[model samples]
Target: MTTKRREACPNLEANLEACNCSYEPCGRKGLCCQCVAYHRRAGQLPACFFTEAAEQTYDRSFDRFIQTWS
Candidate 1:
């Protein structure tokens, strides 16, 4: 059996440098679709979840993601 690789979003490459979601051992980096899905399923958000200031705080919890977006 073999698994297929997910397609990479070109936009993610441009934003990886700014993304801070450090919880996952991922390769997608910061693309929205992948990031959102990954986080939503886990009840959390990607490193790009919060602003630079908020991200620096390292509060990647689900509650923090809502508070930041809300």
Candidate 2:
């Protein structure tokens, strides 16, 4: 399957307000598609899947996400 380059999300500014990622220097902070794709490629979920406390740990693993919820 081919992936198309996505346009910047229309809600980027609003998304940033709600983004809980604790990583200060992330390039993909407000770019949800890029953030999701980046993490998916690594078999993980983006920091948004995690709680603010969990996100700070920067573990991004799918297992960690589940453990956080469970």
User: All candidates' TM-scores?
Assistant: 0.51, 0.83
What TM-score does model 1 achieve against the real structure? Answer: 0.51
**Residue 9 error, candidate 1, Å:** 1.5
lDDT of 2 by residue, 1-70 (tens): 1122124566677778889998888878788888999999999998888898899999999889999999
lDDT (Cα atoms) of all candidates against the true structure: 0.65, 0.83
Clashing pairs in 2: none
lDDT, candidate 1, at 50: 85
Candidate 1 to native Cα RMSD, angstroms = 5.2
Give the clash count for each candidate. Answer: 2, 0
In model 2, state the lDDT of residue 7.
43
Candidate 1 collision pairs: 20-47, 21-47
The parts of candidate 1 lying over 4 Å away from their true place are 1-7, 51-59, 66-70
**Model 1 Cα lDDT, one tens digit per residue, 1-70:** 1122223555555566666656455655556677678667877766775877677676668888788888
Task: Give me the overall lDDT of model 1.
Answer: 0.65
